[model samples]
Target: MLSRTYSRRVDRVQAAVDALELPPAVYRTCPFEPRELVETGLRQWLRCCGAAMLDRQVIGMPSFAVDEAWHGLILCTERYAAFCRRAYGRFLHHHPQGGELAGSARRAGSMAEQLRRTAVAWSFVARPGEECVLWDLDVRVGVPEPWGAGTRP
Candidate 1:
């Protein structure tokens, strides 16, 4: 069973991340349409990432829009760092595959494997009856090369 304190903490962190105002330029870089949907998905993804940090899990990003939003957040170094401390008691680092840290334990696997892990992570953090739209967010938003069609992450 989960304690109220834990639940409240999750809620508080989710609310804080959702309230974050990402740079306007981020929407331009995202390869998705309907800014509203992208923003909504991005916030949910960010909240999940924050919650996943509690268990030190390496949750892969499945949506380009969400990834773009994350990039924007990281650009605001001060705010992103402080948000991490408040939400997860530490800084959430981004270790993209093929980067200098490619061999690091934090580096994610192939897209298929990464998406699988993302789905599993979502299972742990999602609220009851909450449907995850991240897997097919690209398709739903009409991205040219959608990553997955009916997948859930």
Candidate 2:
């Protein structure tokens, strides 16, 4: 099973991205599963088959790029994303507690390196050609109430 605390981390990260309000032009989504990250392989594979998407050739030809608004949203939070997606499957929730952690720290390390290098794409999806910032929940929840209800409790 997965630990509730570990799962909570993913939820928190997701909420932050939802709040960032990124511009529409800079991000997008690709029509492929995270597991199907064969960007270069797919291109080469297609050439061998002598097929294309214009005529509905392959069973799953990429119709769009992950650079799209919604896709970018998902791509932007790639840090906890792989874990989150696998955890939620159909929806977002805390992970069950039991299964041992998989994946390597090297991936997380790479993401950290990218984050230090950039603040926008800086957070997740290091391989991304383009990226934007996801909000920081730690700061979000601290924001004061509306002007009408101003003043600390």
Best by TM-score: 1
TM-score of 1: 0.79
For model 2, residues 1-153, the per-residue Cα lDDT tens digits are: 436753454444444433434343223333333322323322222221121111112221111232122344444465335433443332222111232146433323342333232232122222336322122211222223211111111
Residues 56-123 of candidate 1 have per-residue lDDT tens digits of: 56676777666776787687789888878776677888876665364664455466666677776666
The residue-level lDDT of candidate 2 at 127 comes to 31
Error of 1 at 67 (Å): 1.3
How far in Å is the alpha carbon of 100 misplaced in model 2? 28
Clashes of each: 0, 17
Query: Who wins the lDDT comparison?
Result: 1
Off by over 4 Å in 1: 3-8, 100-102, 105-113, 150-153
* Residue 109, candidate 2: alpha-carbon lDDT: 38
